[model samples]
Target: MTEQPARWTEATVYPDMWADPDDDPRNSEGPSPDGELGSLQDYLTNYRLTLRMKCEGLDAEQLARRSVPPSTMSLLGLVRHLAEVERHWRTWLTEDEPLPKLYGKRDADFDGAVAEPAVVEASFRDLEREQAATDAALAGYADLGERVGKDGVAIRELLVHRIEEYARHCGHADLLRECVDGRVGQ
Candidate 1:
């Protein structure tokens, strides 16, 4: 029988090194912000940082590797999905009228995740750009209680949802990374 290939490679090692939650740059300083922005903002920032840290140092194949059989999730897919989610909440939810979805095929992010260096780089870049846009939009709103979505979601609710979404996905990422290589932490 053929030996199973190692999911993680050298490149994956470095990125993971940089973001180990125990040693993350953001964590090195004392405690994070307190009530400056409120609980929701703090939570969102924490989750966002967690997601980026989880993806740090992983290579294309490692990022694209699914956790196990019957599951299509991948770190790359998570990044792309989060990017879409951020865009949707920041733009669509904030708009006076509903806007078209960013992705035509709902599952394209997952289906398209691949073990290609270029694809992985593009996915990360897209995530960064989308996150920046979302941050800018959020900064424009002074009131978290302001209603934004047609479904009656307030800005605060959407922000909290984004944090929860990232936190959940980061947990998945942690497991996937551990399965790929024996290295595990944060």
Candidate 2:
């Protein structure tokens, strides 16, 4: 009997991360209705979901594996980093009674993202809790244009910033995951 070589395309299982729009769960059905807050919130929600989706199905070791040498970026690091970011925004919104950070000092979030089941689990928990808290804080504001805190940052700016943060990190995640196991996309 003659042996037949297996057929393979390239790095990933699928030709592209999003080969079929209709079947791609990551595709946001469309934009949120016509309001500013509604649209901004929808974009923020999608980015947050995208980050989480990128880390899905990976074990602690894989999640904590550094993307490249000389950098501490990892999927797990991003989760912890985002959790801290959300906590910071929450504190900003509640200026009079700011909450303590999840990871004290700068960059501690990424520095502490070690390869452990507990850490991975806690990172996810913290991210979820902080995200909910941030959302709750935003919910209290009726107007996105309203100035907030001692910095006088507008609520709209903060919301938009969060979306931008998530979008940038999600792009990093795409490359990291592809390097990790050739598994790509949502």
Candidate 3:
């Protein structure tokens, strides 16, 4: 096995990152949307892509590697956690009754994140499924001011909240990705 540096190398595959700026997949894919809703959608889309980009090319073990002591956070854990977030939020608007959490009764999302290919695969599958479901739920709302859920939170507020959620976690993914293999990107 290659010797992991004292902490990490000053350079890696992309000379301190996994991919070059020219080839970075973080590049937004289509025309920028044109207004408040479009802007929010655009930001959310980019951040989602960013989180996935950060996890790319990692093995199941690396993806599940813990970040620092006392923290169960991992790329894999983040995926599972976000999946739960997506599901919980969507159900607030769609379901008449509360649904059981997918992972566990406790901190199952992170705790259950293990260094197994199957776990990694399932985590991502759940994430994708939940993300799509949440998006579909949001689509039913025409106005950002439209209130939903028990708290009666507005759709715009929820969208903003989701974006904030992803942004915060993506930052964690950045540090975790770098710690895992010294890969970094913007």
lDDT top scorer: 3
Q: In candidate 2, how many Å is residue 28 off? A: 4.6
Q: What are the models' TM-scores?
A: 0.79, 0.85, 0.87
lDDT of 2 by residue, 60-167 (tens): 999998867678999999999999999888766745876777888778898899999999999999999999988887899988889989788899999999999999
Determine which window of 10 residues in candidate 1 has minimal summed lDDT: 2-11
Candidate 1 segments whose C-alpha is farther than 4 A from its true place: 1-22, 36-39, 95-103
Worst 10 residues of 3 by lDDT: 4-13
lDDT of 2 at 172: 90
lDDT of 3 by residue, 76-122 (tens): 99999999999888766743676679897768999999999999999
Model 2 CA deviation exceeding 4 Å by range:
1-14, 18-23, 28-31
Q: What's the TM for model 2?
A: 0.85
Query: All candidates' lDDT scores?
Result: 0.72, 0.80, 0.84
Off by over 4 Å in 3: 1-18, 29-31
